[model samples]
Target: MTTELRNQEITIQPEDSEVVLSVERISKKFCRNLRRSLLYGVQDIATELSGGKRTSAKLRSQEFWALKDVSFQLRRGEAVGLVGSNGAGKSTLLRIISGLINPDTGSVKIRGRLAPLIALGAGFNPILTGRENIYANMSILGLSTKEIKAKFEEVVDFAEIWEAIDAPVQNYSSGMAARLGFACAVHTEPDIFLIDEVLSVGDVKFKMKCHRRLAKLRENGTAFVLVSHNSHSILNICNTAIYLAKGQLITVGETEAVVRKYEEDLCLSGMEKATGPLILPKKSPDESFGLDITLVCFKDAQGNILETPMSGEPANLCVECFAHKYIDNANLGVVVKSLSGENDRVLYFTSASDNEFLKISPGNTELQIQMPYCCLIPGAYTAKIYIKSGVCSFDVVESFRFTVQADKTISRCLFYQPRTWKVISK
Candidate 1:
């Protein structure tokens, strides 16, 4: 593109001397049909050759904006994670930033050298050996023959694919190529690193090594714009995050808050009526079980509905179950699950454990379990209820999710334990 488009030049704040990358009001569109895309490509080429500018502001038929009005700036020593659902244009934004593709409108300004692991194995020729491909990529990165030779052993060691170092790249699996690409990029120590989800390809050990390397680079003030579905990785490596939805910027802030919001949005999106206040509709009962879980919610001691409760604060678990026929005795159990992890079972309690049993009637029965205070840490959780008789499950309710806001007296933690300390030892 033209120098006028350099680094988006939107604000012209060179005196700041910190901002390393800037994307200004950028947008890009793609055509659905391959033939139409190629035709449009040729037409644009012709127009450019004839000194005519194609209007990028408007879209042709079968075209949709892959990214729209996206803008952000990355400073030295900042690692920003991009979290979004599939087809959210995260990869498209990375490509544009890496100069693999250009935006239809606006421009991107990158102040220093960039190393992109956006498309692993993209530059390797089928017939070329991995060794040869590594040399070629380093050469293209402005490393001389001597520098490339010096770093060859280091790259292979980091990639952990030395056994196939001399094998043709065509014989390499996607994971192998990705590991090699990641190894090469990090070893070069570019000023800015554009990482997509290629880190997800390798084994856990290799991924750990990658994270360690990224940590070192971050410590040395190398900026990163990483796109990944793995929030755990993002939380571990990034201090900030950006959330995107339908090619639009949703929120940009501290990594924990942004990731949490994105995840809750995903959970909320799957339910009916994504817009209105969070009230779940009654679901049908299992005909075989002859019971229905009509409503499950949380409330305070005052009986006011609490969408989110405070951590380590008093809360009430309320459930309304409709029993089809009268039953002699039913055992009620509730399972509290932590959503931030892989649906981990945090707590489970049952009325049977307390030597109590419910006599089911042929109508809705309200059950309320009051807790002195929730001891769980601040995070998302779900409560699941099940009604059983002897050993047979009669009713099973889906999880109802809610967040526990951090108590003013406490902070985010793994687990909460009330304790007191003394200065006796000191």
Candidate 2:
């Protein structure tokens, strides 16, 4: 098969001066070592050099490409988010840009000083005091001792570790270490910043402060490339985004659009129903009395329940149940989960069985429910419908999945709440 980027030459033109960084057809390859022990590396090399017939079993290695011909450019003052599942080369790309490692085939053009917060406290000395470690990190990032001293108080306050600054860095908590690293990097006046999932380290207020500082830097023409799995964080901060899957670029566009697509993919993956019934296996005919859940469905408005819907669209959900024996009052409920299996948001839930028709005697019966539009965000969500016949809650349906998509052209996620905005002359 022809290479995806074979026709495109990997080069950055001088006329594109506004672009601060250009990644040109970059690719990274790593050998997945079947044996990770210390002796394996030396033994493998020796065997290869001895001219012995190399069998596949003896080699026990495969060339794993962590990034495949990825190319993108960031102009001055642009903030872009790099999104992907774990091991999708987000960190590898960041390291390549930060000059920590070299790509196998492609080139990177970076204009000015790059401060990379790729791994928090990666360069810090654990045995040293936090103050000394701060100085060391600042020096590594190309700051003079006098400059660090001048900005010392500002950094300390910004990190909110004024008390711990004098203590050994080894004694600091993980969050404190991250804050110190981030604080030092932000003060380095980097023209291009490479951040990898460090914002989730600190407290909410500190994160807000970091955002403000980054905003100011952005206004001053600083370009930032961020990598995170949190779509909400990306939607709130980044203008553009790139989604990577299995070390290849899948989608790259405005942040909101890429986030929506990523979420939709996740939801579709989980939409397949479980094998047996809607209830768990433990409560099936093996253990519990002769009570069964027949069918469960997620619906949209107009009496049509689709498995997935785009964000801001009207939708409906329904659950059908059947009882083998006489059943009394029952409580029905539903829960929603994010694409990563974290509880996303509850669409609708009810425990009151006011209507007696819900109390089925036997055979088949259908219970329908409706949810209006604009409730859930543009991401993958799962619905866990439950019907409690006895004292405890029994699964009517366990984590039925659905996806919500959004328009790619518009940057609307959190701000898409149903509210009118009026603009007047200030």
Candidate 3:
């Protein structure tokens, strides 16, 4: 990689200028059942009605740790990515930082006014018109009437909702509401910002505007804690990244390194789960069509099963498919699923031109497929590999299963080519 390509310089401001946000050993626990407490209440009432005072009744419940001993600090002008699998405490951490939820332990120290975009339409009145909702949201975001009035046009323009500015928010689509909420949040002149994947909404143009606004704020020493599964966004913008799992921060480092680690952890966990001997599904002999997979692995540059690789290195995927018949013209493909099961991002598909089509003459054939590194982000992603010969195209398939990790050290940025930035100071 050229110096210009590999070395994407980020301006590092002084770290001692009063840490904008300090999250120290914070943890959050939740009770699973409210009905248990209700039952205890009824039991206590029955005991008291018998003319005998009862001691405190135990509340049957199940405990869940959403966060545990997670610590990090954000100096002014710093941006950090909070990433994790679903139920990995990414949202919980954001909620705690936004003060929407209190932590069970430790503390969050935040300085200056904060703008949180954790939830779309969190403060908006659904029944109110878009104009009224904007006003209400701005007020809740600490904007004065005069300030809202002054920036009203800019907000509408940024949100690209000039035509629907007067419509009720309830009538707006989810994207429209998200755009409005994002507009209101950015309008507030805040020293700290907490965002949770709100940029995934709206169109590309709106997303660009949001990125520009974030860049402007970041240049002004406004710290940000962004919770997102989109590694590209985090890598392109954030100075640091933290990966959380099971309510604990598993990794933290420079944006590039941290993203790579997060992807690695995801792959490792999935592999362990898939490789455990007891994961085999029970089979009933009555079922005629039964298929199983074994020895799923990714290949390095030299066509070897690769467990890990430095960023920017070459890699490929190798999986052996076992079929029970002479399947011809099978469409071999792989679908990469996120850990959260939100959506499966297609990694690769080959019908006959993958140059990898194999004809099984009533026997099992080892099929190896290769994919370049540019197609994936540096994160843990699961894969579903299959061979389909009929219109069904799913004769031998694994949906919502399998896992593969991308190697990113080969690139300067996280997954894609690094973008250029020009710094201008008056």
The per-prediction tally of clashing pairs is 2, 5, 10
lDDT of 3 at 60: 31
Residue lDDT tens for model 1, 1-426: 113345433333433468888888889999999999999999999998999999889999999999999988899989899988888899999888777778899877766667888866677786999999999987776578898899999999988888999999999998898888887788888878988887777788888898889889989999999888766667777878999998999999988788778867765666652221234344455455776666777788998877776677788888777777887778889898866545678899998999888887888787788987777765566777888989988767666767666635343345566666778764
Highest TM-score model number:
2
Q: For candidate 1, report its TM-score.
A: 0.80
Order the candidates by TM-score, highest first.
Answer: 2, 1, 3
Comparing 1 with 2 on TM-score, the higher-scoring candidate is 2
- Give lDDT tens digits, candidate 3, residues 1-426: 011111111112224556877787887776577886567558758986898774422223575678888989898899999888789999888887776766656777666778998887778888889899888889888788999999999888877788988888888898888888898898796888999988787788878888998999888889899888777677777899998989878889898777766765665663545421112232333442433344466667676666543334465555554555566666666676654324546355775656656676544455666545434544555566666665555334354343334432532333444346899999
Expressed as tens digits, the lDDT of each residue in 266-353 for candidate 2 is: 5555335522223323345565454555666656666665645555666656667656666667667777766642344645657564
Computed on alpha carbons, the lDDT of every model, listed in order, comes to 0.79, 0.72, 0.69
Best by lDDT: 1
Instruction: Give TM per candidate.
Output: 0.80, 0.82, 0.73
Off by over 4 Å in 1: 1-15, 119-127, 170-175, 270-288, 301-303, 325-363, 367-385, 389-391, 399-401, 407-426
After superposing candidate 3 on the true structure, give the runs of residues whose Cα lies further than 4 Å from its correct spot: 1-16, 35-61, 270-331, 334-346, 354-359, 362-364, 370-377, 390-395, 399-408, 411-426
Candidate 3 clashing pairs, residues 3+ apart or interchain: 263-379, 263-380, 311-408, 311-409, 311-410, 312-408, 312-409, 312-410, 312-411, 383-402
